[model samples]
Target chain A: MTAQPDQNTAKARTFISVDAMGGDQGPAAVVAGCLISAKANDEIAFILHGPEATLSPLVSKHPILAERTTIRDAVGIVTMEDKPSQVVRTGKDTSMWSAIESVRSGEASVAVSCGNTGALMALSMIRLRKLPGVNRPAIAVLYPSSNAQGFNVMLDVGADIRADADDLLRYALMGASYARNGLNVDTPRIGLLNVGTEEHKGRTELKEAYDLIRKQEQKAGFEFVGFVEGGDISGSKADVIVTDGFTGNIAIKTGEGTASLIGRRLKEAFKYSLLSQLASLLAYTSLMRLQKKIDPRRVNGGVFLGLNGTVVKSHGSADATGVSAAIKLAAQLVENGFNDKLAARVAAILPTEESPQE
Target chain B: MTAQPDQNTAKARTFISVDAMGGDQGPAAVVAGCLISAKANDEIAFILHGPEATLSPLVSKHPILAERTTIRDAVGIVTMEDKPSQVVRTGKDTSMWSAIESVRSGEASVAVSCGNTGALMALSMIRLRKLPGVNRPAIAVLYPSSNAQGFNVMLDVGADIRADADDLLRYALMGASYARNGLNVDTPRIGLLNVGTEEHKGRTELKEAYDLIRKQEQKAGFEFVGFVEGGDISGSKADVIVTDGFTGNIAIKTGEGTASLIGRRLKEAFKYSLLSQLASLLAYTSLMRLQKKIDPRRVNGGVFLGLNGTVVKSHGSADATGVSAAIKLAAQLVENGFNDKLAARVAAILPTEESPQE
Candidate 1:
């Protein structure tokens, strides 16, 4: 558990710690994703965690991954049904745990897992711990949007169901930092999500968070857009949308489900008649362009913020495309030194009881 | 206000109370909507509430509404910015108040408003009052879905920001009843909205509500599909999705935003190239069909559940089409005696302190 020598030197290849056992597609998909990442970016390497006997063959199958990937032995697996508390106590021997340990031990720049979200977060908190001023860590996802950047950063999408006013303020700060470092948005506009955009609407905590976020806007290096409605999540109103995990999780899932439904209906629309079928054939490329613009797999990773090290939780049901996209995101974050910047940003404006602002 | 004699006999026309002010498009849009509804249904009549000088001319312009509509003068208006508490105290002279009074006086089968949601709900609760056993009233909206009925009923969508275990249980009961009476589902399936579908997932209150809703499933005559995620709101997994107002409101708005974004992207895709434009022209009918299916205006009303009388809150910025859709829903609910049936269904399954269920 001691810190390993920092293999990720300034000019050296970036190493990503990946859990290859827990994904729905198994080690093969993980290895395939790793090979895809290695082929696409020569600077990326992976420390694959799982049963060596199971993963070694998969890694060997991909000649491209042979030199770029290392298989680490782990005996256990954290099932989807495993409680986070139970995993924290007994999951030390699991691939998910080992993957996070690599980042904690400084052997890898970031960690990626397509396992149980709660367990991965629990393990990340216990292993790497939280940043100095952070009371609770959050999971930030890049939601497809109509903004110029094509996506918006929304957090805490299921790390914890409840977040008080201070936790919300911290999410705004962390989310803004992620947008700047990860999404490349300078002076990111931070919006506190509520039922309505009116200052008088929404819960008491939201109003309190509004004032707190506004006060720290200048020091935190972000713009406060006052309060935003749920519809503004995908609109161009803000680059970073912050809310408690309970509402954030529901909003993100609801958005995904709605998009999926529309996609299905669009397909159905094209098959209704012979003329429509011919039209679909003529507009195939255009339809593909639209589909690519809103595809959920293109933005698959949910970055866990406030932790000492970066951890990206891929969807449990993600395929190779999703896993590859997550790895690409992890590499991008590592290259940008997202963790260090986020830590500094949060610590700089963190409110204190003795401070005059309070 | 005294109760007017019931003109709505078994064979008589159904009278609808309309708030002719407070909409974004003003009273013109309200009168246009009334004309649309009057022309569509011969068995419907309206009591329009607004300033006499303003509404009389608008109603007179529509020959179809001349005999079907009655104008009631009210001096004041409820601007969207007015606080719900303030409206409750000084809103007696407003059109929104007068419209609710029509329902309270038994002159109208239902009340319809395209005004401030909080003000409408506050006024509805104060004038119409909650049902005998209902503690907090909830607003239920029909969400576009993949179900056979083409939509699912989701409740507590911005009625109030909070709902405890007991209140959530009531929402489940009322939502199920709505699916049966309003949507005409034989035996509606109810699902508790949670971050995850697992038994171990979500808040403590959700778990408690889960057990309570389960106990009444058989007696309440609805199937309890335990612990549905936000994705299920638009999926075919359940017919009724229940959650607290804060989460529900955000989820619905998020869905609308996502759908609207996709629609905009689709339009942009059609305009990307000459070939795509030709394809769009060729597939106009099919695309129109798809547009009509997912159009927000088609399912525009948010029905206030747990109230003694039926009150439908149309979107504040709803156009004539949206307003007409709301009126259609109100007329359908009145024809089916939805409020009385809802009350009876709730009272029948309501658990009492002395009851064995408690």
Candidate 2:
């Protein structure tokens, strides 16, 4: 059935292409997330990609999404086990490919997926292509931080296993731009992630990138905070933290794991005795507030930067809340015209082929 | 005055060489830690390395240490800003150098330092030297984990920045041995840290190291779990986590930062309202239990592996509790004869120059 043209549609709604089949919770969670977004936002819509037989019924269950959702059928599925190289060659009929195709076709402003990260990245690169002057595309995520903004932008979480000096410079510019538009920070400060804050520490490549990122501070409209250790990732030292994919991927995951472990232990502590049980009941509201402050589900999406179009990779096991968070992030980026601004920001300071040297 | 030869010392006490002047809290904390350890364990002794004028007074204040501690008069102190190269060339009189020298001269079974990590590692390498068949030395730290043992062993935290296939295999062997002898684990399980558990994912060096590590599983007396993600670092998936120094450093620091942030937020949450404050009082014991479970100070020491002598690098800002934890770890390793066992473990599985192939 065709989606009805609602009154909000006439105002140029931002369309988010979502893959409905790949998440561990399946299509129902994706549809529920869309309903949550649709109920909260009138200027957003979704083009859901999956088997019509499955997604149509799920969308029908949510009356709010009936006017804002469109289903596209695809037979193939990209499981967590699917190899990215194999998916690139033979994933034409997959829902993930179809979801990205909507963004490539200019029908959607951004694409959201809970599929295999490697497969999703491979598909996005092949479909959307990298923006000008971006040697390598990076995945940027918002981390829970003690900054005034309550978050910090860190890049190259797992886009590729490696990044060089030029790639890091591009990440700094693009990440700073993201902080400006997406996070709305004026003159975002950038910090290169290293083992120590010392000038002569870390590997040779990090030392080389240190000078490169610092040189572009004035021209890029950002402050260079020199080097930062992993402790600074959640501190108020910088608005944007840049690092190679290998280190970034491990850092974020370690943060996630540590937070989860503390959360679990807190629950157990509250159940230890009768007094603790009553204390937990009395402190439930405050504990919930503390939980919301560090909730990973609240910051669920990892935005793939340096691509022609915006792509938000939701956690593979994300529940309805996580999916909704990802959708909200995608909507915000689209509303702010983040991709176009990021492209302009990179092009402005990028060295030309004639004078590659800074 | 000379230290009295106590009954415990007559029974061959394990002497720990301690650098007292370099910590942020100065020698007072070091002396306090020795007092704590001396009161707790009768078979432990210390060779306090620093300017005698500063340490003598500090040691005098702790009666328990009067019979168990000997002050070594080293004139120079290695500040955190001192370069490793500079310290190695002219650090003969530095407390850190003197600490390592005590271990080298066969007076102390292990050395514990709260000095510059680079300087400590450099001096340890110079004085203790690498064991036969060991290429690059690694720093092994105990991470709070969900394992039955309450901790996991992770290596190469920041000793060196690079690890090739052979180096990774060595880390696997060394980390596994540390888990067994230090943590009292039988047939410790080893996991190579990567961005993903998938065999096809991560760098080529990792894939090669995976096979090389797997080849030594039976011979090394450990179970190789193939690959593990960052989340598994705190999970019960493996007892020993192996990684390059750069990633390991970032992971551990990220864990520390996140834990610290959660702790600060929890305090604020408890102070949000009067009822919450009262509830926090009731939950004080339980919350403290949870806090003690994840306290970084409880696991404050990073052990230097692959060297002829064992060295524990305590946190620079460690207080009495932290320093005591480091001393306890050093005492345990010395009691277990960890260095000799680790060297033997490496010599058994290490590829010989005559037959370098697996």
Candidate 3:
């Protein structure tokens, strides 16, 4: 697609604010994505915040963008190489902090960033705070499927590494909301990713987490399925999969690596001999299709859920296409009012004043 | 592939013992696999071990099988469903135990099983004992790759969970030795799998392990490469990647899941409509080629390296083809004297006086 400059999508109630200098691709891709969103649907407003020196030139090219897109400049906060511990002290002046704070202040409905993940998370927790009834936040990502248009959502990809049973339940609830709002799946099937599918598998924490998920209060509108193995991440057995960030990150990266390996190896094999080249040529179209299915850039990135507002964490190594995808996802989340619905759902599950801690 | 009778196989130096009751496919697939191996490679032997009541009649159709095959009737053993703690107590008279003993007693060169991994691991650790200069035994397997005829080789798939710095170094040495003798890769480059390739990145275990690998007592006939990501598993960047079993297991399972997913998705995408189906039909030969390239079953299983004698573990759910591959790998490991080479190599790396401590 063509990414053009635009001030406003359609006259919609929701607005998605994106970090102007986030991600490895810089602001051009995000700007292009905003332009693309305007060309397609006009129901969302694009809020871009970052260094004006780098973003304004890209925005000025598209004459139609003057009214459709608005920009805010931040002094600057975090970089991909910044230390996670440093985000807390230095985020006051960073673009990521400014972008997130915009959502918290209600100037924008949601915020997205492809900057330092740890910094984004740290700033989000400090600025957005937890949704009233939630504990820690979760990062939910959608892995695109080629045969199917819908995506499988993995929660807590890199946010909450060491999670307990209750944390897992909250992750599931958030993931379900993500699946429903992002993909529009009706009653998304949620599964807890574990070492085994058997009831008695996984470590003690996972076992306890399994029971916690089964509690009536935790299984909200979505179908809380049983255990899922690493295999389920690729297949369409579940729309939403909940796991600690450590395993989820590894799973996502492993899938990405394997797909890339497939693509690269096939290319290398094609160069080996004439017969192989002929075979590779024959399979070219199919390989291209499969690549699209596994392409990290096309799938965009994941959204860090459970924050007071919106904050999308794109991989630092992601390319222009990936940045564009993140921009689109941020818009979708904002237009869908994901946070409000998520907060409402979470409040219903959390123990209230009447049901004080046991 | 036709499986020769046990006697026929025994006549050749390439004798391989198989546990008939192991794996999800059970006896039928194991029997079929034995026949296939015996028939395909005349130099290979199939020392079938299981209940005589179950095996004798299966090969009775070919009267010539009497001279070729022999059955060692085992009354009982550990089932895959059994817990690891009870494997030894309950599997006293089992086929799995008997098969491993065959290798120890020189009755067979290698014992291959596709049974409960936990049980197999516990039994092997106790029965085989660690080789000289080896701290802990590791289970290493070959992954199907696009670079060579097969996939990349990796170690510590699931044998030990909590690997220390020294254990990783030992695994690297064993994997390097296996690559040199078994895969015939001279001066094989070994890599440590971590979250990032940078020296300071990843969990503390990884960072410590990386330093030891990069600056440890150098081993002969091996190149110590730096850290690699999950992508390298398929990229052929390094032949052997050393890590704790937990992460390795996750990576392998995730890779398998993704490869299957990519294949399924491409098929669906190709068949989405009349137009796509036309493209798919045109690319059928290519699709077949891709499937063959990424088939996990073809890799079959991995060897429990660092054991006193050779032992190979097949996937619990392997089919006849998978079992056949495992049998071949075990036989090859014996023929190559893989353990002997690894023992000699590792012995030279450490002090002889500390051998007892190791």
Isolated chain B TM-score per model: 0.96, 0.97, 0.90
| Residue B78 lDDT, candidate 3, scale 0-100 | 64
Q: Write one digit per residue (lDDT tens) for candidate 3, span B148-178.
A: 5355678887787568887888888889877
lDDT ranking, high to low: 1, 2, 3
Q: What is the CAPRI rating of model 2's predicted complex?
A: high
lDDT (Cα, 0-100) at B173 in candidate 1: 84
In model 1 chain B, the worst 10-residue window by lDDT is: B1-10
lDDT of 1 at A4: 23
Error of 2 at B229 (Å): 0.8
* Candidate 2 accuracy as TM-score: 0.97
Could you give candidate 1's per-residue lDDT for residues B53-148 as a string of tens digits?
998889887777877788889979999999999999999999999999999989898999999999999999999989977888999999999999
Among the numbered candidates, top DockQ falls to: 2
| Candidate 1, position B109, lDDT | 88
User: Tens-digit lDDT track for model 2 on B246-310?
Assistant: 99999999999998999999999999999899899999999999988899888889999999999
Q: What is the lDDT of residue A76 in candidate 2?
A: 93
DockQ of each: 0.83, 0.87, 0.35
Worst 10 residues of 2 chain B by lDDT: B1-10
